[model samples]
Target: MNGKQKQSYKYDKHKQRLFIIPARITSNVNNDILVIDRIYDDDDGRVVVLDREGQVKWTYQGNPQVNSGDKLFNPTDIVITSVGHVIVSDVNNHALHVLSGEGDVLTCKVMEDQGIIFPMSLDIDTKGQLWVGCHSGDDQRKDAKLHVIKMSF
Candidate 1:
C-alpha cells in the first residue's frame, strides 16, 4: 500500500476545543480515537477521545484531587485495554489513570512509591499484561526502565 495521508482534522485554538501539541494518538479496540494533548511544553495535559466519525466523545483533564497543589496532570502516553478501558500516563505526577470507556474516572494508580518515578507510556499485550515505560529521577534518559504488570479488568 502506498503511504499517503488519508484524513486530517483542524481546529482553531481560540474558537473550539483544539489539539495543542498532540504527543501520541491511537485508537481503541472499538475504533475510538484517543489523543494525549500537552497544553504546555510538558505540563497541563489532557486526554481527548473521539468517535470514528471525528466527533468529540469525551475528554479527561486530570483528576482535580490529584493535581490540586503543585502537581500537574502532564500526560505523556495513552493506551486502550482489551475491554476498551483507557489508560493514561501522568509523568509529572508519576501515576497511571484508568478510565471507563465512557470517560469516567475509575481509579488512579500511583507508582512513585514503588520506584516508578515518571511513567511515560503504556500498552497492553495480547495476554492483557500492562506494560509501562518510565524514567528514574535525575538521569531519566540514561536510567529509563520498562515494567510489566499483570492487570485484570
Candidate 2:
C-alpha cells in the first residue's frame, strides 16, 4: 500500500462480525479505544469501548433518564480523562455527558447556564481540565465561544 493509502474496518471480536460505525474515537491511558457510533434514522447513538486486541469491553447507549427528551443525539466528539472517565459532547442535546469507565452515566451537564450553545468539540488538558468549543445558538452566528471547565474527577 502507498504511504498515503490507509485501511479501516469495523469488526467486533465478541460478536464475530463487523458492526461499528465509528463517528469519533479516542483512547485512554491503557490504550482502550473508545468509539462513538452514530446510528442513522434513530435516536439511539452508541459509545463502544474496545481493547487493543479489538475485543469489546463495554458499550454505552445513553441513559434514558438523563437523556429523556433529547437522547444522545449526534455526539460530535469524545475525550477520555486520565482517570478513565469518558466525556462526550452531545451537540443536539447541548450538554456534556460524563460516563464511568464501565459505561454507566455518571452525570450530564447542560451547558445552558454556562452560555454553551452547541458544544461541538472538547479536550482534556495536561492539568485535567476540560476545554469545550461551542457554537452560538443564535442564527446569526455571532456568539461562538470556548469554555474551560475544571474537572474534579
Candidate 3:
C-alpha cells in the first residue's frame, strides 16, 4: 500500500475494519462544524452539520424540498453561494441541488446533459457563475472538466 497517510483514523474492532477519520470544517455562518457522510443507502451520500465542538446542527436527506424527476444521488461536494444557498454536487445524478442556507432544497439544476457523468466538486466565482468538476463518469481522460452556468439573480 503506497499512498499518503490520513490525518486521523478509527477502528471497528468488532467489525474488524479500520477507517480514516475526517476532520470537520468550521462553518463561517456560526462557527459550527460540518461533515459529509460519504455513503448512505443503496443510492448515494449525504451531508451532516455539527456544532463547533462536534454536535449535530442539521442534515439533508436525499429528499429535496421538491420531489421531481431524478433526485440527488451520492452527493460528494458542496459550496455556499453568495446569497447563502447550499450548493451540493450530486455525483451519481450528474447535477446540482440548490438549497437554502438552513438546508432546505430551493431548486435542482441539471449542470450537464451530453456526456456529463459524475460531478465531484462545485464552486461559485466572484461573478456568481457556477463551476464544476467531473470525475470518471465523464470518461474524458482529463479526470475532470470545467463548466460555467449563467447565474440567475
Superposing every Cα of model 3 onto the true structure, what RMSD results? 6.6
Model 2 lDDT, residue 110, Cα: 80
lDDT of each: 0.83, 0.78, 0.61
TM-score of each: 0.89, 0.81, 0.67
Model 3, C-alpha of 135: deviation from truth (Å): 2.2
- Per-residue lDDT of 6-113 in model 3, one digit per residue for the tens? 333232334432312232232546654445565435344566765544445567755543223555456677777677777777777677777777777788766556
**Superposition error at 6 for model 3 (Å):** 18
Model 1 Cα RMSD, 1 decimal: 2.3
User: Per-residue lDDT of 1-153 in model 2, one digit per residue for the tens?
Assistant: 567834344666545644436778888878888888877744457788888777888887665655776455567789988888899887777888899888888898888777887898998888888999997767787878889999986
lDDT of 2: 0.78
> Between the candidate structures 2 and 3, which one is better when assessed by lDDT?
2
Clashing pairs in 1: none
* Alpha-carbon shift of residue 82 in model 2 (angstroms): 1.7
Candidate closer to the true structure by TM-score (higher is better), 2 or 3: 2
User: Which segments of candidate 1 are over 4 A away from where they belong?
Assistant: 12-17
- After superposing candidate 3 on the true structure, give the runs of residues whose Cα lies further than 4 Å from its correct spot: 1-26, 40-43, 64-72, 114-116, 136-143
